[model samples]
Target: MRRFRARHNASARPGRSALTSEVGWFVVIGVASTVGQALLYWVMRHWSPPVLANLASLLVVTVLNTEANRRLTFRGSPVRAVQAHLAAGGLFVLAYVITSGAVLLFRHYRPTASPAAETLVLAPAFALVTVVRFIVLRLVVFRRRNR
Candidate 1:
């Protein structure tokens, strides 16, 4: 027992839990994905209807997000991946509602807002949503209890 304790203590490093690593990766991925989503939305808006562009960007990013989180954060199995996709469906809708509402409200209040301004407003808005997404992904969808 003493030997085991020594070994465990020796291996322990402060502020470096598995969860900390996962969160670090999650933040990295979230930043990259947010930029990608915003850029995709901006470019697509020029060629497609606003609603369609939103859907396309949301769908693409959500799928990519799920896969990335499954591998990097959750380290999920095949079944867990399927479950993550299902959970992502609900998350995607919730995120869309949150982001789209922000956009709509911004437009209503400032009808002449530039596209750049809209993106600036959305960056922080989506950053807040990203926190919620991480919580749901970690606690609910990828919880070990489910598998």
Candidate 2:
């Protein structure tokens, strides 16, 4: 019984380590993706409307983000490439709605808020979506399959 318990714990250690590593990679990739999207949104907003810019920037970054998560953060996933990306699309939609809604709501209230202020509104929205995104990616998109 003691040997069995030790063996089980030893095996479990790698699982825990893998989860930690996955989360770390997720954070790194997510931060990079968020910054890139914010910058893109800033640049696009100069030429396009806020909602259009937000939509375009998110569309661009989401592809990269999904690919990065699939390749780096969730490297151990047995899911196929196309399937992973397709699943991530749902997350992208969720993020877009949250972030764009926040920006629009801010604009609605302030009427003449600066771009920087609008960008600041995204901070909390991103934080909220990121938490939800991580949970979905971990549980649904990147879940390890028992072989």
Candidate 3:
């Protein structure tokens, strides 16, 4: 079994290893971003509209995500970090818009719903945005060849 494991490890492709590492890094960054966003959302809940709270959360998470992705995920050059971060931020905003629109559409269809019900409908919308962001970040912002 030990020999089999050793052979399996040795036979793994270089790109596969890097991809695995990238995924690990993504999870780490995602956790940190989630925590940051949650905290920001909690703090702003009473003071702002839900849409504004969401935007503030997005902004906070994006900054944390950019720094984490640059230093840990891609190990990108410092020179390119700012450009990559800006591009990622644009993508983040696009995702946010899409999610927000989806939530608004749902709310329009169910105008009498409770806030909890609206939040349930919005969860999948934000999830869609997250998946898109992950793909864009991996394929565009932090591609191995580009870095």
TM-score of each: 0.83, 0.92, 0.72
Q: What is candidate 3's CA lDDT for residue 22?
A: 79
Candidate 3 or 1, higher lDDT? 1
The regions of model 2 sitting more than 4 angstroms off are: 1-5
Q: Which clashing pairs does model 1 show?
A: none
Candidate with the greatest TM-score versus the true structure: 2
TM-score of 2: 0.92
How many backbone clashes are present in model 2?
0
- Tens digit of lDDT per residue, candidate 1, span 1-147? 999998887778542576797798899889987887788777776676445766788789889988898998777444467878999899999878887777778878988876666666666767787889999887788765633
Positional deviation of 34 in candidate 2, in angstroms?
1.2
Q: Please give me the total number of clashing residue pairs in predicted model 3.
A: 0
RMSD of 3: 4.3
**Which scores better on TM-score, 2 or 3?**
2
Which order, best to worst by lDDT?
2, 1, 3
How accurate locally, in lDDT, is each candidate?
0.78, 0.86, 0.69
